[model samples]
Target: MPFDMIGGRTFYAYNSHFKNIMLKCFRKLSTSSSLMDKRYIPRRAVLYVPGSDERKLKKIPSLSADCIVMDCEDGVALSKKEDARSTIHQILQSQAIDFSGKDCSVRFNSVDSGLCEDDMKEILSASHLPATVHLPKVESPQQLEWFAGKMKDILKNSNLSEKLRLIIFTESASSLLDLPAICRRGVELSKDSPFKLDGIVFGSDDYCADIGATRTNEAKELSFARQYVVTVAKAFKLQAIDIVYINYKDLDGLKVQSEEGAGMGFTGKQVIHPGQVPVVQAAFSPRPEKVEWAADLVKAFEEHQRAGKGAFTFRGHMIDMPLLLQARNILQMASHS
Candidate 1:
């Protein structure tokens, strides 16, 4: 709030303690290891294809993204909203695209926007359905509840074999603040619901606009919000999606940003361009060195536990429960990647 839109230095200066704040946030993040033991689908690179773009839509089946989001929200223009919905509906119904081994999603307008009903109506007309629906700009738990009820009413009689998963965007101050409550509430309602809350995607551009955070080349302005979203999302056993790299032409910069997000524990990234998918996919994957370490650690952990060994030092670091869980996660990722 203290800086101009293009001036990020003044903003960072005021929030200089964000590093410490992020550290504190992460220190309190880990929950029971049983949460980590649950099966999670890989969402390493979430590629958003505008529903109105026929060229991109035709090529969607060829893209190797872990998740494909047929977007009818921000990516579509107001004038083409109906057209986008029609196009997406046709694609799903026609089976023009083979989405085997990949997760498909549709991004509807925010629940508050009055356009979500139209989006739902389009989906209802189709016999086919996406595995996920992305809800952008959802700031409160009530909105999530509303969507759940609305979706149940609309899709109750549909012949969907899989329960649809919902992913919300965390790009506003209110969203960042009430995120935990939203997830907790969603988790509660999900136990018996037709649709479930699955993950949170960070929309940095809208978030910065909402909070008046100045722009930065490397997005340092979004550092705290980014890390905080990942921490809270993981705490509630939900996948955390990192912000999109707007400069699609710069694959190198995108790689750095993607890797940074991965190191921060984001399970996936939002990609707008085809070129960015492979970079993000590789960035989110386990490296060979790390995989070897994880493999060795898993063996050590198994042996030590079988031999009645408690927390012991491995490679000069304490192999506690959290690290052991992390090691297991790495191995799982290694096998999947």
Candidate 2:
């Protein structure tokens, strides 16, 4: 038998036919030369905190989230937008919030909101700039192009054009439909441009409202949209972050949803509450058994390659370049996590 029993469940130890299929699929995906760099930057749990809340801002240094997003968008009240921007600028400038080696980003309002320009201006003017800028409600490639153009001027003036990265949030059906094009623009911007497109985030709350669809605990309503985001992100080699789990009180539900998101190919999840951070991070991290298997596969593949073999058999399965790549990715993720 090619399967092995582990923890009372059957695991596919080897399957030559399945390996061949995966090899073909990966080869097709790799053909896209425009694919962005797939660096494993531990973005498993991205926590959002309202920028206007000084109490919350003060507490950020103690949190263990892989990425902290100081939100100036939907998280802030309309009347408090200016205050939030000012507060965020102060927090960044003070350098009082210790990132603890975590990535920091600021989510500005949408381009159409008429407040994004001011938000960018204030945030960019800070002495301690965020590593990334998150753009919400991205609907078209043109909007990204416009923002990129504007950011060029800001970053040029600040001398940080090459340092600041960008991650866009898709919150509407229109954005979902134009995902591929948006991702293409992202790739284009990263090349000889000031701002690099690091990833794409899905905002299910806004998307559900935009589509007039009711959200349920089962989450069947978001399957197609979520899968589309993951597919486009993988095609472009960008990170795909899943929607936030609003039910922060339900830890079990959060874990279940996080596992589902990870299974669906999302590299990370967004969280509103601090308690959800560890759960999401654990869910997206590589399993110990999988990491061990990946290491073994790499070792065997290397030995075979040293013998001048392009493809070889491993535990009753075919080991090829695609499979090698998969093993390497798994190892990389495990090491970073």
Candidate 3:
């Protein structure tokens, strides 16, 4: 006897809940000739903006990062938390800002943190909202569940699309221990809607401190956590973000780490400063030789397929299905950039 009241029409909830019925109704009402096929693009760069910094907020529209995270969690001081929240709200209303097409986001304090409620309320009030939400210091699945519920409530009440996404930062030992399960939670949340469970960011600085390790150029102590996060993310088909390189003045160090992260399968890196953006971009961009190899693979594969062959060899080496797929991916990435 479940029902919904819509514009004076009472519809049976069971029929509405039925997938086949819903699909028919959607098709009958849809006016578009073509289906909406939205593809997921990997976020290549995410720049962090301290919430309390007016200077940074003013410069956001001019910034060239794929995503911009207005951080109200770690970046703001205790005395400035309220002020930061105010600034975020004001920025949303300001006529000067428009992050519509960008993968704009905000990192709220962890649900366990007392500031989460206020942070959520402030974000919900923004007229110009972000496309995704970054959750910091997530140590357990329960925290993920709680935040998901809160986001759902916000969507329903605000009349905004519920396609909000979650990008978690695994910063603690407990979080690193359950990286695989955490990624699973994201997939589960995205089950029935465009709303997504996106990525897991490895917070290297906090991770090292939690494990009693120090930040070094080698990053030997953080290697296990870094590699584990990337593995779990790939398993779930989610984005794996590398940690931010802290030394702003050390462009060489940043480039080296960015290269290492890219070679290790990380899709992107967290940039702490504007100076690091070009370095990360350069590292992530496909090289000329790799791009050329990808082009050759595609040509060879097409020819083999035309000849009724399932596989082909290229460059005097044995090339197979998996390598062909990899080459195509590399080519696609290069073309997109």
Best by lDDT: 2
Model 2 agreement with the true structure over 221-303: per-residue lDDT tens digits: 99999999999998987889998888788877888999999999998999998878767777887775776677677667556
Q: List the candidate 2 regions with Cα displacement exceeding 4 Å.
A: 1-38, 159-162, 294-337
Candidate 1: stretches off by over 4 Å: 1-38, 289-332
RMSD of each: 10.7, 7.5, 14.6
Candidate 1 vs candidate 2, TM-score winner: 2
Cα error, candidate 1, residue 274 (Å): 0.7
- Local accuracy of candidate 3 as per-residue lDDT tens digits, 27-132: 3322222212223444667899999998888888877666788889888888888888888877765635777546778888888888887888887677766778
lDDT, candidate 3, residue 128? 65
The CA-based lDDT of model 1 is what? Answer: 0.78
Lowest summed lDDT window (length 10), candidate 1? 3-12
Cα-based lDDT at residue 36, candidate 2: 25
Give the Cα error of residue 265 in candidate 2, in Å: 0.5
Write one digit per residue (lDDT tens) for candidate 1, span 1-337: 1222222111112243533432332222223255342435578899988999999888877888889999999999999999989998988888788887678889998988889889988965777888888989888889888888888888777766667787888778988899899889888878767677789999999889998988675999998999899999989878899998989888779879988999999988999888787778878877656655765676666567679988888889987766765665665554444
* lDDT (Cα, 0-100) at 280 in candidate 2: 79
